[model samples]
Every structure is written in structure tokens, then in C-alpha cells.
Target: MGEWVKSSCNSPVPHNAFVAGRDVDGSRIYVGRAAFQGDVLPAKVIPNNRVAYVSHNGSEHRVQYYDVLVGQEYEWVVCGDGLVPANAISPGTTSTLERLYVGRVRHNNSLTIGKVQPSRGCILIPYCHREHSFNSYEVLVKKQRPKLWKSQSY
Candidate 1:
């Protein structure tokens, strides 16, 4: 397994850290548009494929857990918690993610980070019987409730 770190000016360094099943080298960042303009984007160090679906709007990006359909954009706010985009879509839309740790909440209209359980997922990485078909594998499908954003939870 491997580890990576995310350091941001708005928040503390090493805010979101995780162990990756594959080699996780943070030597370079695959940065893309922050989905917003003039917004000080948070330094992100998510796994190769995990992220919170974000919808970009007029000079802003709404980063949320809810799926962001193409051609649409929402708000431009972030929970103080770290983010993990959906790595894969299970049969029931239960997203399989990687390096999604820590919970976030809104306190007095301010983002707050909370307790988090280290998590990782991939169809190729078997947490169960290794002989199952990649698409039909149920190991990652069997996860606890994944509430995108709890009002005051983790």
C-alpha cells in the first residue's frame, strides 16, 4: 500500500491522508480547472480516480456528493471535509470510491472536518473471493450507508 498527503492554505496540512492499494506517488499533481474562477481552490491530493462530483456554474463550482449531470452546474461551496470522487458505479448506483476519508459538517455556516474511516475501492482489487467477474464483484458493493453530505455528521 502507499500513502499521500494533501496540504492546503485554507486548512491544515495533511488534512486528508490515506493508504492506497496501488502505488500512490504524489510527486506530481494532475490538476484540472478548479471548476470555479476567483475561488481559491483547495489543494487536493485524492487518489488517481476518486472525487466528489462537482458542477461548475458561472465562475463557480458546486462540489457535492450528488451526481453532477453534464451541462448543469450548482453551488460553489465545499464542506471542510476531504473529498473522493466516485471511482466506479456499482449495480445499484452505490459508488465505489478510493481514498475517501474523514467526514465534514457545517457549523454556524462554516465548514468543519470530523471523524472519518479510511476507505478504498476498486473492481480489480478483491476484498473477497478473487474469482468473481469484475463487474459482478460484490465486495465494494457491500459498504455502509454513504450519505454524501450530512448536515452535521461524518
Candidate 2:
């Protein structure tokens, strides 16, 4: 884990998913892509290789999860970048539509969904996972949700 520091803006630098003096202990959580493998609850989940059945635009599809890279102290975002383009599909329809996604990072043609600091407009690097298998894996973009986001304070 990295040590927290004071930003030039004077705001406490966020460390290990917690913004100094802004986040509560044990408040950060992650959620899975679907209500399976005990991910029914609204919390963070370890991305394991499981048959994740998701629904998008009233359509159902099966998505495979690979080994997810987790535990990054901080993340940076490519401004104006969003969900990576889906390649050619084997059985399902593969449309190369550029959708507006809030919490995905892109490097070249590959894109991975991970935790995002909505307040800071940044993404968590370690949590990013690559899952685009044109002939094997198909993720429902519309049904996908950001596993990490800033909690709305009441």
C-alpha cells in the first residue's frame, strides 16, 4: 500500500481507494457483473473465471471472466476514451459502436473495465481486466456497470 500525501491543491491525496479525510473506513466496495457467485450484494467482487450470464437491451448472453489485475494504488484516465471496441463475433452480433462508458480504460485496441474515481475522473489500474474475446467471450456493454464509483453521500 502507498502512503497518503497532501496534494498541491491542498486536498488529501487518495490512497488505496480512500481519499484522505474524505472516505470512511471499510466504505469502499466492489460489485460483480451479475448476481452470481455470491455477488448478489452490492459490494466489490474478485474477478474469477466464471460463466457470467448478463442481460443487455433485453438480450441475454454469457460472458467469461479472466484473471483480473487488482490492487493498484492509483489510476489515470485517457480523456474522451471509453469502452474499447468489440471485435468480430463468432456467434453473437459484433457491432463496432462507440458507446459512452464512464469507467473503462483503453490502451490501443484493448479496453478493460475497472474501478473509477468519478470525482477525480480517474480509473484504478490494478482493477482493470481485459475480457474481449471475439470468438469466445462476449460482454454486454449496455448491461455492464462500473464495479467502483464514488458513493453518494446523503
Candidate 3:
């Protein structure tokens, strides 16, 4: 588990991770993808309140657990039970869209990063992977890397 560091607006976010923000209802919103009637829709806000990441054996990626505050960034380590199906999203029509939620699923017996999919309900996952049914994966909002200052020797 990586140590929690107070993150500022300029803090660096790891690769393949989403930049979480609060909605009007004060819930954490993750903009990802959703499966609808055999089609994967993009830019859809995940109907959940938490975000997650998979920390590899030698990974330094830290999981953000709460709203960013000065001198106090919340974070923790998470592990999967290996019970949830990788391709857990069920196809739904427009009428069933309200019941759709985002969940993470990882490939069995692999240490790769998990993929986000539209689930019947929100499945909070610490890590996950892929399945054959899913083709393209959702790419959410990412925090920009801080620019480094270059010293010029004239």
C-alpha cells in the first residue's frame, strides 16, 4: 500500500486512472463507459460514489479514497476476492438504463489493470481485468501532469 499524500490541484495522477469530482449531490462521480443494447456508450458518469485502482506487485499507484484537502489526502489499499465475473455487465435497453451502473472486472490469473463496464449495480472493486465480450474500454478524465521547469544555461 502506498502512503497517502495531501494532493493539490497540481498533484500528479497515475496512468489509466480517472480524476474524480463531486457532483451536485456531493457524491464522487467517475466519467467512464456504459454498455447499452450491445453498444458501449462513452462519457457516461458512473452511478457510484467511489473510485478504485489495482496496485501491482511493484506498482506505486495509490488509491484516492476521499475528496482532496490540503495536507490530508485520503487513500488505502484494496484487494479483490476473485469471485466477481470479469464480464459482469449485462446488456440493457433504454428503459433499463436507470438500473445500469459501472463496475470493474479483471482477467482471471493475471496481474493486469482492470476494465470498467456497465453493471446492473455498482460493484466497488480494488482491482480488475478483461473479458472477450468487451472490446473497447472507457478512458475517463485524467489529471494533467505538472510541467517541469527547464533551466537555461546561456
From the highest lDDT down, the ranking of the candidates is 3, 2, 1
- lDDT of candidate 1 over 4-67, digit per residue (tens): 2332223322323321112134322211112223332222222242432121121212332221
TM-score of 2: 0.21
Residues 1-154, candidate 2: write the lDDT tens digits: 1222222212222333321111123222222232323221111222232232233322333434311112333333233222222321011111332221213333333343332322323333222233221211112122223589798999
Q: Whose lDDT is higher: candidate 2's or candidate 3's?
A: 3
Report residue 120 deviation for candidate 1 (angstroms).
Answer: 19
Q: Could you give me the TM-score of model 3 versus the true structure?
A: 0.21
Ranking by TM-score: 3, 2, 1
Per-residue lDDT, model 3, residue 147, is 88
**Deviation (Å) of 45 in candidate 2:** 6.6
lDDT of 3 by residue, 37-100 (tens): 3432222132342333322222212243322211112121231232223333322223434322
Better of 1 and 3 by TM-score: 3
Error of 2 at 21 (Å): 22
Maximum-TM-score candidate: 3
Query: Using Cα atoms with residue i matched to residue i, what is each candidate's TM-score against the true structure?
Result: 0.17, 0.21, 0.21
